[model samples]
Target: MNKWIRKSAVVLISVLTFGLITPTQLITNVNAENPSERDTVEGARLGSYGQEASYFNEAEVDKDKFIEDLVKQAEMQSYQKFGTRIKPVIENEFREIVMPNIEKALQEIANQFPTEDLLNLAITESPGKGQSEKIFNIKNNNTNTDVLRFHVRRDNPPQAGYWFNFHYHTYHDGFQSHHELGSIYWDKNTPPKWMS
Candidate 1:
């Protein structure tokens, strides 16, 4: 089968199995190595953005997973339906509107998984063909602007098989000289210590 068709199959299976959205499949439709594989997904993400208002609401999973699923499904389905002849216009919508929403939402899901893998796929799979750049050094340069690559560093990953306290605690100390205070990524939004 062609690449787009294969991606479609993968998406169908994944969504049904996990009941979770997968935007990367849409991105892969564009990144199809065979060139022909990159047909469906690459084009439609841009094309379908504003067409169906109900598309975002079609699948509801409540608070934490809501934004993640919405972004994933909307982009995936849209990209899957785009045509090569009209893909340019479709890709444009992804760059301007679709991606930013995804970015903001992902930030809120900063559980424990590093943001890099997820963002990387978004950029690689996006229609922009690598328009978004990576903030970290993990190298997987697939060209798709809609997909963005970023990283998250937590003290531990789940299933460590053991428990310990004060292992990954971070805190703010008293003020120091101009050069003493280093730039920390976690604040109230993330907090000093990595808890999750």
Candidate 2:
């Protein structure tokens, strides 16, 4: 069996047994390693899978486990803030929708970058009072145009709700500032900028 297929099967079984996600909400056809539903010719033309992502291939990449860990952490965060029990429906939504978006973004990044270079990237987390961010430092020699961050946060004051975002940041040395490339919303309005 393929490595991704085997890992995905184990993750699914674990999630089902642990009640992290419902059986009806499971993503059946999506591979944990490559979550895209479409098989475009451009992907082939770009040498998507042929590239030697030796670092990523060196060890088994359990993407599903990463996603599941994030979900479990987020659920705890939500419960702490709202003092309300997280319902199965909410977990279902994250499992069926939010996770796939993140997975697809990672897949897009892999396509855009060399596997070995991406392997050198750094992962960091900043957890504050109301918001938390997970940052992937895409170390660039010339400029800091390679950072990817995902924010999971709740609004303050009047708006008391939760929102999640995945976006890229480009730092300008001249301006001593960073500019956002774009955002990936929960709604389907725009594809993730990380892919671009």
Best by lDDT: 2
Residues 16-103, candidate 1: write the lDDT tens digits: 8673345565455446656553454444434222232223332321334434544565455334433343234335645454456444
Query: TM-score per candidate, in order?
Result: 0.20, 0.34
How large an RMSD does model 2 have?
13.7
Score each candidate by Cα lDDT: 0.34, 0.39
Candidate 2, overall lDDT? 0.39
Which ten-residue region of model 1 has the weakest summed lDDT?
163-172
Error of 2 at 134 (Å): 5.3
Residue-wise C-alpha lDDT for candidate 2, range 52-123, written one tens digit per residue: 123245243344433343334443443333222322324456556555665555455445555434433333
lDDT, model 1, position 159: 43
Clashing residue pairs for model 2: none
